[model samples]
Target: MLTIIDKYILKKYLTTFGVMLGLFAPIGIVIDVSEKINKMIENKIPVVDILIYYYHFTIYFTNLLFPIFLFLSVIWFTSKLANDTEIIAILSSGISFTRFLRPFIIGASIVSIIILLMGFFIVPKSSEGFNNFRYTYLRGDGKQAMRGESTDVFRQISNDEFIYVNSFDVASKTAYNFTYEKFTKDKLAYKISASRIQWNPKTKRYTLYDYVKRTVGGLDDKIEKLDKKEAKFNFDLEDLTPVVYIAETLSLVKLNRFIEKEKKRGSSNVNVYLVVLYKKYSIPVSAFILTIIAVSVSSMKRRGGMGLSLAIGIAVAFSFVFFDKIFGTLAEKSSFPPLLAVWFPNIIFGILAIILLRNAKE
Candidate 1:
């Protein structure tokens, strides 16, 4: 149960967090606005629209960094108490350090929950609209979004098939320098080469131009020339496009569906998508872990006041970001489990929080 003092501290912590995020976010965007000023002007983004742009930016900007601030907020609030001799006074009143933590935990827990919601559910959805708005309106003439529908560097329609192309133009929905391979019975059965492959949207089939087909069996070889008007190949946008964060843009259900489709097709390099899926859920729980870390580090009164706490909070937060990237790189390039890569940083920090909480109380 939280006593009156506990409630007071909790309120203070939350208040500080809100104020800091509230102020810092706009300042950050203002900085962004300045950086993009030339492009914004060139794109003719109106002043009013600029405000709307900032509004959208804040949703993602704040969400992107809320966990960091929440952790720092804990440190700031706790350290303020310590630096003010309030912590000593509370301890002197026979309130054990452990007992005093109840309120901080409670406060941090609430913050964590809020942050988690923003990270998984709210932020991803908002980011798409925000990014689209910027690229369409604020990015100006030098930039053009990937408008073409055709894609390359993907698993082909046939099982054990693969294709790689330098670029695909959306205007014609065609790919160039296309090579398609087919493997059967664990043997390379055939190879197809086309200078260009196009999508006839009206027909819902692909057409390859100036193509050659070759087949090899044991010592037998055959070659055929293609002068056909169109060649039919079934591939969806999701199948051929270089899997970027497109999977991430989808909701949990949609993301899972994509994962299943890609798996059934025997596409490797689905690790990035899997990472995004797990992170959607895992990131929310981190709100809890980060809160614990913050309260443990910051909720004490020290001579340096909130500044010291803030620094420590930032250090821990950055460590999480750094390790997550490092592990992600390892997962993509090396043979590490994608799930483990995304979650390892969180796990490490969570353990540290537990240890810190124990040490803080003692």
Candidate 2:
């Protein structure tokens, strides 16, 4: 069912895209290494760890800049075709412009599939490794940053139970001025207070210092006190204090579950997680939109030649990234809708692609 021209253009499309990634990935690695080498040396990082970090870094880099690389590749190859009059020759052979675009759409579909799979599965794992390595060795106070806010932590662990801690220490897995309360039908049921609480990972239990429990009843209150007590809670340590980048480290399924759990907990940063979730889909859809835009922009010979096309392509790509970041930040900081913020760039550029394609066809 495939024509000779379709195969030829598809091969060119895929090969050029691959070559673009091949060329830029090493440059990205080199730049990253140059920036982080001193920190690695200071930390006395192992060679194996550094190698592993770069492996993850490659995936992270490719996924982050996929659109730019894809756009440039399409423009580069299509401009070459235009300069050589190859596209003009093909079109003169009684092929309609819309028919000529079949291969490009197919290529875009292929790239979109790859992007979707990577965003859903591969990039999450690589992001975890890349971000963990950076925070563990590259940044000052990274541990505290990863642990998120350590003071005045409060969370609803369940519909009826809530917990609070004045301060937490990441290194010791300890909380100070810990309080736990339970409510039944909006009425006070019981309360537990501890001067300090330390998690014993080996035992999967908590050791509470100066532990006290008070029970509420009809016209009566009973209180119990203890010097120290070992207990188990329904929540994990991560549930108590999650990392700032925890959402980025989870795969699609886990991220969905995490969002649901956070929604139940009434987390204020739910918008941030929603933005991440929506972006995983929006970015892949941009592959199609950007590919179309690139082809439309560069499919004709110009007085300025490939340079003009490339300049336009780069400007458009940067504008797309700029719009994505602006909306993402707005959603994260304000109450903007995450779904709208993620898709707005794609929607704007999609319309631009349509206009450009129509002009190119004419």
Top-lDDT candidate index = 2
What candidate 1 gets wrong by more than 4 Å, as runs, is 45-53, 133-242
In the predicted model 1, the residue pairs found to clash are 75-298, 78-299, 82-301, 82-302, 83-301, 83-302, 148-170
Per-structure clash totals for the candidates: 7, 0
**lDDT of model 1 at residue 184?**
89
lDDT of each: 0.72, 0.87
State the lDDT of candidate 1 residue by residue for 1-362, as single tens digits: 66889889889978988988988897988799788887776656668766766776888788767667677766776777777888889888999877877776687677767755665566666665565455455432444423332334655566676776644543346566778788888788898888877788788777878878889867888988886447665556445444554564566666788888777776666777787777776666776788778877876666666777787788898887788779877877777998898889888999998899898887
Error of 1 at 171 (Å): 15
Q: Score candidate 2 by TM-score against the native.
A: 0.82
Check candidate 2 and list the clashing pairs.
none
RMSD of each candidate relative to the true structure: 5.7, 4.2
Candidate 2 residue lDDT tens string, 1-362:
77999999999999999999999999999999999888677767789988999999999999988989999999999999999999999999999999999999999999999989998999988987887677556666444433324457788888899899865654467777899999999988999999888899999999999999999989899999999999998776655444456677789998999889889888888998999899999998998899989999999999999999999999999899999999999999999999999999999999999999999899
My TM-score estimates for the predictions, one after another, are 0.72, 0.82
